[model samples]
Target: MVKKTDVLVIGAGPAGIISALTAKRYYPDKNILVMKDVKNGCIPCGIPYMFWSLKNPDDNKLGMDSLKKNNIDVILGKAVTVDRENKIVAASDGEEYKYEKLILAFGSNPIKPPIAGIDKAGIYPILKDMDYLKTVIGELKDAKNVLVLGGGFIGVEFADEFSKISGLNVYLAEILPRLLGNSFDEEFSVLAEEKLKEQGVQVLTNNKVTEFLGEKKVQGVRFDSGEEIKIDGAILGIGAVPNTDIASNAKLGIGKGKGIWVDEYMRTSDPDIFAVGDCAEKKDFYTRRRASVMLASTATAEARIAGANLYRLKVVRENKGTIAIYSTYVDGLVLGSAGLTEQSAKKEGFEIISSASETIDKHPGSLPGSNKIQVKLIFSKHSGILMGGQVVGGISAGEVINIIGMAIQQRVSMSELETLQMATHPYLTSAPTMYPIVIAAQNAAAKV
Candidate 1:
């Protein structure tokens, strides 16, 4: 039997949901269906918060009420295969869906280290399914010693959250010399590590997990240098693997980075097929090189573009590139970064001109609850254009990186930033005379 729909979106992640909703908004009468492998998948970004911020697992649930309110059908099943020629998708439950346009928002999977004993009962990888999350929560509730593998955002966030539980021993390990080495500059990395340490998290750098030693469940992990650290459980947050097997089976062109290759319009090799989210390849905004960024924010933006242009290409958003903007908060301190780090910039063969400024987030430095703010700007010494930026400060750090991202996207010259106007208040932000962006730009101006 043949099922019909105007657009079929597989995977009800942020990208999938946004695509379906956008399609429904644009084509009100069109049929829209979303297939999610997990019946109850929590929002990926909110999963780490289950440790401290959220009292219960249900707090992280991504309610489907918005989708239901929009008249979109959500199927609770995994898609088995796609018949591109027939324009149909077959679910594992013998159900079939036919669509005029197919959007594969199937997100990525976490990369589980193939270490011995990883399959033990106490090892947990970052997963979207809420069932596993509940299991993890139960296990961790009684876990006194928890080891977090990796120092990326996920690992750091997990460590920060788990460390909050009274009496729980939390350690965040990384092979690199700095935490968030891939995104933030050294100063910001140092500051972040300091904050993580202050939050009762044991920060370990230049270390790697060698083996998981346990009989029934993880008891401890062996370091590469033959030392061992006892732990009740382990959270592997190294990286992720994109979900592209179905696309591969359907002969979709995959990029060298192992993500599905799509054009500016998000169209895969097959004109009728499109890929977005963590499974899709993206270009670097500054370097024009293939980038492997998998932020939910990036995915949703891509979904918006893909959904709006799926029917007749109404929007003209080219996947011009990804800035890889990233942000995370811990114990009320927010850290944000955009584009490349100083190390990455140098590695990419660019002569970097960098500047940083540290001042109070609020004016007068005496405002109640005021905290110090640090901003770093990196630019090409020759071109004098903003290549990257990092901010460690106030509650606004979460959104402040957008300015840096925009600067990188627009290739804003350092000279143009000196005269830029930014609003500020004595209670809310730094004085206009001490604006971080302009201040950092001015510092760069001296050397450039």
Candidate 2:
């Protein structure tokens, strides 16, 4: 049977859901159909918390209530091929879809490195599917010593959560010198490492795993230095790659980042089709060079842009580039970063000035729940424009880094930030007289 729809969206992750919802909001008269392979999907960001924070794994499920409430239709099937010449999509369910406009939000797949014995049992690669995660949870219940490969946010978070499972021995292995090395500066990475270590996580930095060791299953791992550790289970949190098999088979242009090539409006080579989320190519905000950043936040933003521009150029705001903003929490410590880091800026050949300020989040530093907040701002030395910033402190750091992101997007200058006006209350925010953001800007302005 062949189903017909004015707008067809593939994948039901954040990108797919948001794109469908936004399209409905813009073109209420258009019929939208979203085809998702998984009947029940889990929130991408909330997946890590399912290990411990969430009482039930179902708590992290991404329900279809939103699409249902909006009167959008959804189907359960995997799209096997796309006939762009006729605007038809064939799915594994033995059905065809005739789409007036198609949006691809197929998302990404976890990267499993090529190491001997890696395919052995007991090695779980993080996936967004709910049924697969349930299986992982069940298998992990019997694991005594757990090893997590890669020290990015996912690996670090998994290590932290696994450490709380009563008597589980969790080990985190990072080939880099520190955890989160690509996202944060050395100091911030060190802070995260310290917090993880405090939670009884055995962090092994500068360690390269040569191969997975086992007879029939993954029983241990041998490092390059010939050191081996026995582990009952292991998780591959290395990274993810764009899922572009369908797109490639359809003869779509792939970008340098190994994702579907799309223009500023998120339209692929075929004007009638669009791509968003991790499946689409991304460029650096400042450099305009190909970049690999797959975040739920970035995906949704692209979805909105693609949805609004599907039929016509309804939204003037085109995606300039990806800023790579990120935020993560460890124990009680929260870390947030936006744009480029100090190390990254230097490597990009930009003459920069960086400054940091430490202050309490609330007034007087004696407030009952006041916590210390540190802010770091990086600026183009010659231009004095905000380029990047990082924050560490209470939960408020999450929003604080967002404020800095806006500054970077707008190219706010150091002098302007130094005198920028903001709302403040005795209990809710830092004192106006010593705001860390303003202070950090002032310190940088002095050198600028």
Candidate topping lDDT: 2
TM-score of each: 0.97, 0.99
Model 1 accuracy (lDDT, Cα):
0.88
Backbone clash total for model 2 is 0
- The true-versus-predicted C-alpha distance at residue 155 of model 2, in Å, is 1.0
Q: Which stretches of candidate 2 lie over 4 Å from their true place?
A: none
For candidate 1, report its TM-score. 0.97
lDDT of 2 by residue, 1-448 (tens): 6889999999999999999999998899999999999867999898878988997999999999999999999889999999999999999878999999999999999999998889999999998999999899988888899999999998988988898888899999999999999889988889999999999999999999889988888899999889999998999999999999999999999999999999998999999999999999999999999989999899999999999999998657489899999899888788999999999999999999999999999997898888899999999999999999999998878899999999999999999999999999888889999899999999998885
Candidate 1, residues 94-131, lDDT tens digits: the string is 99999999999989999987787889888998889898
Whole-model Cα lDDT of every candidate shown, in order: 0.88, 0.93
Off by over 4 Å in 1: none
